[model samples]
Each structure stands twice: as C-alpha cells, then as structure tokens.
Target: MMKKNYITAFDGLRAVGVLAVIAYHLYPQTVQGGYLGVVLFFVLSGYLITDLLSREYRKNQTIDLKGFYLRRFKRLMPLLVTVFLVTSLYLTAFQPNMLNQMRMSFVSALLSFYNWWQIAKGGSYFANLMAEAPFKHVYSLAIEAQFYMIWPVILLLAFKLIKRRSLLIFSLLLISILSGLEMALLYQPGQDPTRVYYGTDTRLFSLLIGASAALAFPSQDQRLAKLVRARQKGLNRLFLLAMLLMLASLIYLSGQSDVIYRGGMFSFSLLSALLIVLSTQANLYLTRFLSNPLFRYLGERSYGLYLWQMPVFTLFELKFPGATGSWLVLLELILLLGLTEIFYRLVEKPARSVKWQSFKEKGRVFFATPATIGKAVGISSFYTLAFIGIFAMIGIFQAPDLSYAQETIAAQLSQNQTKEKLGQASMSQETIETLSQQYEVSSQVFVQEEPIAIVGDSMIAMTYDHLRQAFPTAYIDGIIGRSGEHGVPMLEETLAQIPDAKKVVISLGINTDGPVILNRNTIDQMMSVLADKEVYWMTINLSQSQYTWTDQVNAELQAASQTYDNFHLIDWYQATIGQESAYLAEDMTHPNQAGQVLYTKMILEALAQ
Candidate 1:
C-alpha cells in the first residue's frame, strides 16, 4: 500500500468528537447528546483500521497479523499503563473513597475487557453519574482495543475465503446488521439499558459499519495509490451535510434513548462513515474551518485529552464540591489542557517514538549525569508512587465492595416482597385500626383498602424491611434507578394488576437532578394518571452542596402537593434535616439502618394525620 495521505480534516473531526465529550462531562445538562462523540469515535476506528488492513492486503497480498497485533500493542499500551499508574496514585493518595469501585476497573482495563467487566457488574453508565469513580471512560477504549485485536484476523480469513472484495464487504454489512438486531432484541424498554450500552456485541455494528465503508471505498487502490477522488465541489457539499447531521445528533441524542438501541446507532455510524470519506480530501470551506490551527492543535492532543479529562473533572468536582459557573468550567478546561499537554509530551508522544531500547539508553544517560540527577529523582519518584498505588489496590482488593450495601438492602427488600406476595397481613384490621387511632387516625379508614401502597426508587428498597413491619400488606414497587418518569408507569401497571391499591406513597425524586421543567411535568403526569386516589410524595433529602438541583426538585414536589387536593407532601427533607450523619449513609442520600426505622415511622405518622 502507498503511504497514507495526511488528511488535516480527520484531525478536525477528532477535535469535534473529543471536545463534545469534554463539554458533556463539564456540563451534562447543556450537552446531553455529546456522548454520541464516543459513537463517532467507534465509527472512526472501524474505518481507519479496516482501511489499514485493506491496504496491507493490497500491498503484500496478505495481512501481517503478528505485526498488526504488535503495532496495536505499542500504540495502545504505554499510555494506558501510565493512566492506570497515575490514576491509581491519585485515588490512593487523595480519594480513597473511590478505590473500591476503581480497583476492578484497573484490572479490567489492563486485561482489555473493561467493557464486559462493566456489563458483568451491571452498572448503568447513565445513572447516578456523580463520578464516584473515573475509569468508566476506559470501557469505550476497551471495545476499540478488542476490535483491533480481532478485526484484522477476520479480515485475513475473509480475504482468503471470499475472493471478491465487494462480496466480503456485503457480508460485513450483514454481520453489522445482525449486531444491531441483537442490541434491539436484548434491550428492555424503561430499564437500565447499560447491558446493551456496555456490550461490545451491541456496539460492534457501529465499528463494522465504518469497516464496511472502508472496504467498499478503499482509500488505497489496487495500484497502491489514492482511490478515485470525489470532485472537490461535490465533496464539500457532502461534508457540510455530514457535519450538520453529526452535530445535530450530538446535540439531541441521549444515552438512555430507546431509539439509539434500535437502528439509531447504525444510522449515526453510517453518517460518520460518510463524513470520513468526505474528509479523505479536505473541503474548500467547512473542512478548512474544521481543520484550522486551533482545532488541529486539539486534534493532535486529542488522545491525551480523552485520557485525562474524566479524572481531572471528577477530582476537581470532588475537591470543590458543587462548584459551577462558566468561570469554573473555564478553569477546569485550562487545567485539563495543561495536563493533557504534559501527558502528551512526557508519556504518550515519547512512547510512540521510542521503543524499550531507546528508553533504557535515555534512562541510563540521565542517571549517569549528576547535573540531571534531580530530574532522574523526579521521574523515579513518579514510578515509585505509581507502584505504591499498585500495592494500595492489592490491599483493598478484598475489601467490602459497594454491593455489600446493596446485598443488605436486597435481603430486606426480598423478604418484604415475599411477605407482600403471600397477601397476608401481620395483624388483623382491628389491630391496624387500633394502631391508627393511637396515632390519631380515624378508625373509619380501616374500612378502605390496605392502608397504604408504596412506589419508589432505591430508597424504598433500602427501607422496605421496616416498611413491611409498619404495613405488611403495603404493595411496594421499588426498583433501583427508578426515576419518576419510569417509576410512575411501573406503579400504574402494578396497581392495575393488584386487588386494591389506594392511598399511595411515592418515593421518587432522587434518581436524577431535576431539569425543573421535566420535574414539574413528571409530577403533573404522575398526579394526572393517579387522580381520585390519595397520594403522598416525599421531598428528597439531597443537599445543595452535593446535587445543585435538589432544591428545584423539592420545590416542585411541594408545589404539586398544594396544586392537587389529594396530593400531600411527606416532608422527609424537613424531618431528616440536620441529622444526616446519624440518619443518612455516607452518600448523604439514602438512609442508614436507624434512618430506615425513622423513615417508616414518619410515613406512618404522616398517613395517620
């Protein structure tokens, strides 16, 4: 294959993809669809990798699988190792709270299977994205690395088995469609789509789409030169169309959108493929704009930016804790750029240019010079601290994981579910009426259906045991990650199937930071469907210091409680105020064991009133 042409436009595209991701991370509400940047990345990787393989085949009549794998290793590993070391050191030294979740991510990242590791853990990328850990970004890199490992071999086999390139490309496209179908089939609507989102199998369609484009529109012709170039004017128009569509998708798509699971991912990838082809030859207008000096600079350092942005933002937020504003964002960006530049110069670029022998010679030369001993010590110190991070991980590898808390909550919830399913009360209605009267409730309410049914998010699951004791007949429809948008529908469905469910307690408003409009709309939606039934909604206990949107959510709940006659406010926020340490978990969101009892007691008292 001929030496590949250096296309400046490709760098601009890299800038767009990475910058979009950075913007999304910095202000998720402002750029909800920016994660589509990762999708774009997958498309780019597939196209370039497939093109590289096709070129190798044309040049030598065979793909050099061993050389391909080695090149991939060199390209990917050094920076990854540096990232692991640096992040490990930072977490161990400054953010020990993150060590538990991140240690496994380290192992998975090193092994090149972090994507599957995330799915196996069942963590939702879209839920509770409070940055408890920073390595989630690595999962996308894992998928790409996995592709680099496997795709070349597949291409080699196909090259031999299928003589015609067009036929082989068609077969790849068919396989890509199958991958998309698998994602669509496996995804469960209104549930955490993380399994599909994190699965390589589901995401492969995006990459394969790009690969198909590359094989179909081979960059290197059989004569080992450029493919027949599209006319500049036509290419410019096409580039404009492609860029516009890509930007629109980036601005509008959401990670949790059902459309993405269904053919939307493929659609975006196809557009990405078109953009890649258009960018193969720089455009007169839009491509020039995209490939300007600033964008090109960012593109050159984009890999470093991608590597460093997550942790820098996460740790910055942790340190400042609820910091916001354009100024704050600018500060974060400046810090990020500075760090990325350093990383590119010191770790990533050097790794690309120098092999082990060169590195060893450089090290020996530096160590031999007394004048350079200070620099050598600084370098040695970094490695020493990185090793300390390694040992720190080993020490905590068997420590109680986040799942321990979930397991305890799960046990209680499971018991509550079992007792509720049996349809038996712990005591007769006479005892219930007596207790109701003791709490100043009218005994007349005993004539109605079961005293209270519950619909909630994870908080309900955490407190279900005490709830069961309080009202054994209470029907609970609590699920983790259940936002009001999803939980209300779930509650309605469950209530429809049950014998009697009235006077419900809704325990939503915690799973997300309310975009105020969405919050009010969700409250209105829940209340509208649940009309003619008594409803009590709980105020979330989130502190403004943690979630800035907490105040907005509580205000909406309070407003809705006044707007509808049957709607009532539980006032958990007021009840639990100033007692977070004793009542709340370390997260200061969910209740502790003692808080669970208090939570149930308050609900009983509210209902009695």
Candidate 2:
C-alpha cells in the first residue's frame, strides 16, 4: 500500500459536510439535509481507516493495533471529555430538568457507548432535544470506535483466508447485504429511526462502500492517473453539479421529510466517494479549488466545530430565544465558526499534544486469552444478571399487592371528587338544572348552585378539579384551547356544545401575549352567538416571567374589555401580578394546583356578583 497525498476535493467535501450540519443546527427546517453529514463522516471514516490499516499492513506485515487504539484515544478523548464537563457544569447551574439526561449522556459518552445509549432511549442524533446532551456528537465517534474494535481482527483473518481481492470484495458485500436486511427489519414504523440511524450494524454499509472504493482502486495506476487528468475539466464540472445536487437535496428533503437516508445521506455519501476518487489526480481544477487555504482550514477544524456548535447554539437560544430570525441565525453561525476556531487553537489543539503519562502501557494481549476474554464475558454476564435481578425484585415486590396498590392510588385520586362536587354547587340553580338535564350529573355535584365556564390550555386543564371545588354548583365547563386564539372562537365552540350556557369565563394567555387584541372576527362571531348572554372576560393573568410584548398585549386586552357592555373585565393582572408562586409550574408556564384554586376563586367571585 503506497501513501497517497491528501485529496483537496475530499477536504472540500469535508467542509461542505461540516457547514451543512452547522446550518441545519442553526435553523433546522431550513437545513434539514444537514443530517447527511453523519453519513458523509461514516464514509470518510471507512475510507481513511481502511487506507491507514492497508498502509500499516504493507509497511510492517501486520496492523499496529496498540498504536492505532492509542492514536484514536488521544485524538478523540480530550475534546469529548472537555465538552462533557462543560455541559455538566451548565446543567448543574441552569437546567435542573435536564440533569438526569445530562448525567446519562456523560456516562455513555465517556465509555464511547453513546450510540447504543441513544438507541436505547429512542432519540435521534438530530432531534431538537438532543442539545441537552453536550456530547451527543460523539455517537459517530462511538460507531467508528466499535467498527475499529472489530475491523482489526476481521482484517487479520481476511489476510490469512483470502489470496484474491475478489474474495475480500465478496465478503464485504455479503456482510453489507446481511447487515442491511437486519437494519430494515429492525426499523420500527412511526418511531424515530434513532436506533437504526446510529447503530453500528445499520451504518456499516456506508463504511463498507468506502472500503470497496479503496479495494477497487488500490494505488493510482499510471493509465488511470493519466485518464483522470485528461478528463479533469469535465469531471470537475460533474463534481460541481454533484455538490449542487447534494445541497439542493439537503434543503429540499429536510423541508419535506425527516427520513434520513432518503432525504440526503444516500446521495451525499455517493457523491463524496466520487469526489474523493477524482481528487487523487494532480492538476485537477476541482482539487485546486477545494485545496484553498480557507476551505482546508475549515476542514481541519471541522471536528471541533461540530463538537462545540450545538452547546453554543443551545446557550444562544436560551439567552435570546426571540433571535430566531434568519439574520440573527446567520450571525450565530459566524459567531460559532469564529468561536470554534478559537477553541480549536486554545483548547483542542493543546489537549491533543498533551500526553497522558498516567495511562499504563499494556503489550498486545490475544483477544481470546483468558484475562482479556474473561473480562468481556464477565462484564456482559454481570450486566445480564443485574438486569434480571432488578426485574425479579420489581416483579416480586409488585406481585403481592399490585391490585391493592393500584386501588390505593385510585382512592387517593378520588379524594378530589368530593371537593369538585362542592365547587359545582356554587353555580346558580337555573344553570345547575340545565347542566344536569344535558349531561349525567356525577354524585360529586354538591347541592349548591353556581354558573361559570372556564377555558384555556393545559394550564386550565390541570386546574379543572380545583376549579370545580371552588364553585361546586357553578356550571364550570373548562375547554382547553391555545392562547391568542382563545377569546371568541373557543367561547363559541364551547357555547355551541352547551347552547343553554349562561356565564362564560375566559382563562387563557399562557401561550400568547395577554395584551394582544382578540380577533375582531371571532369577537363579532361570539357576540352574535351570545347576543343576550352575560360574558365575564377574565383579565389575562400576569406571569412573573414578564416579557415586554406580554405587558403591551395585556394593556390592549384591558382596553378592549371596556368596549363591551356584556363583558365584565375581571382585572386578574392586578390581583396576581406579583403572585408568581400561585400559578407558575416548574416550567414556569402552566398553573400548578394551588394557582388553579386561586384562579377558580377569582372567577367564582365575579360570577357571584
């Protein structure tokens, strides 16, 4: 195996892949095809690793397994660990909700088993939520490492078993076909293909394709080299066309669907291989263009850029969630590249050069030797035993009084049933009689009369039980609807369902700015439906998490309330302004149980008047 010089077009392809992934992360819908970068990485890894192994075999008549692992460990571990540590620190300080996930991600990443861990969790590499895992980028590294672990032994065996290159090709094809069939079979419908996408078995085909390319064109033969050079101009144009196709496919497919291979990966990998082959020849225009100092610089730092980009982007989004417009996104991209370059120089480059003398060198131990072999088997056995033991304990503990425990939980939940009936009694006698005639009155309905209709999103949904308690006989019909669209459309929809409904209570604005004006068309429509009915327009609750727009919107809503005679604007803003603890959920959006009770009480008081 001869050492072929670095191909400039390949470096250019690497740059293309890196940029696509970055753009996709910055603006997901716009750059959906960016996911193909992973496939591109797989193919590139396959080609490079195969070439390295071939070179080692030719030079020393054997693969330097120890040196290979050492180089890989040294190259990948420092940057990965640094990112993981940073993510851990961030989660510890800011995102307590994601701490569990961060811990699991860190452990999986440290072990170079993130691919398997992600698969087990049923999460995609490109999923929006994966930003929580700072080291999710390492799934590719895990796949590559798993491949390396198996490839050396397989290559050694192949060297002994096969004389003809055709035999090696046949073996590769057989493995690829079998692995692909398994991948297809394992793919679950409707579930995210995170497992299939990251699994070593499924992704092996990409690597094998690269290996095939290596085998098919060993060292550049003189006739082939001349032929490639002679057709460089036409080939360069074709390469340019292919690159365009790759970009177009990425953008178009991402917008259309999330099916990874169909959208971008398949086309990108094939095109990348062709570009790699063409770049082997000297004086090629495509090669010259790709070999530019800037493109090469980006390609060199691509790994670091990929590692740091997501965490940086996530923090940016957290700080300025409203800066989601195209120009701002572009600014983030520029900032990411600049920051990545700095990190590469200051952190990654320095870490790579620093040797870990603490790592004790162990000489080549046979894969089948008792100590090495037993360690793998023992670890596997221990895990299997541990899983069974945990499950067995759970089964035994649950087996005795599972039904009783369920009943206990059910009984506890039913405790509120009594309170809800008391709240329903707060409704007027006329409204209670009307509701009882329409729907089956539950035994929980207390013998009091009240009339109110509560409506909003999930915030209102959680509060329904407590609301029923506050106004026992109040004809409380809480309908969950989105904010901004809340006022008239929701009221009309609920009124139409219960035509004889008297009092309409609005409790929305969690998902939208409170000051935003009600849709006039919807308002007119509601006024038309409820021409003679009394409507109590509840003022939007002031969240402790105040935004400038929200303040403005609340003021506008307050002004609108004065225009309608039937609408009695209850100023919840004044009452609940500083009382965040009353309404805010852990996510700081929905009202908790206590908040629901407070809100229900306010609405009941207005209806009572």
The clash count of every prediction, one per candidate, is 0, 29
TM-scores of all candidate predictions against the true structure: 0.79, 0.60
Q: Encode model 2's per-residue lDDT on 1-609: one tens digit a residue.
A: 112455555666678778887776665546756767767777777777776677678678788888777777767776676565555455445643434345456557767788886665444443222223345667888888788777877876776678887879778867766666666666653334556778888878777766765665543536657776678677768767876777786666552233443323444556666666655555666667777778788887888788888677666655564355767777777877876775565446654554445222543222112232365664564455345445433332332222233223223222322223113234566765654443334323434243455554434555657665445545444322244544555666666655666776665544431112334444555666666777776555434332223454455556556767777766667766677666654333345556565665566566667
Model 2 C-alpha lDDT versus the unseen true structure: 0.58
Clashes of 1: 0
- Give the Å shift of residue 382 in candidate 1: 5.9
The parts of candidate 1 lying over 4 Å away from their true place are 1-4, 129-132, 221-231, 360-453, 461-479, 482-504, 513-535, 539-598
> Model-by-model lDDT, in order?
0.71, 0.58
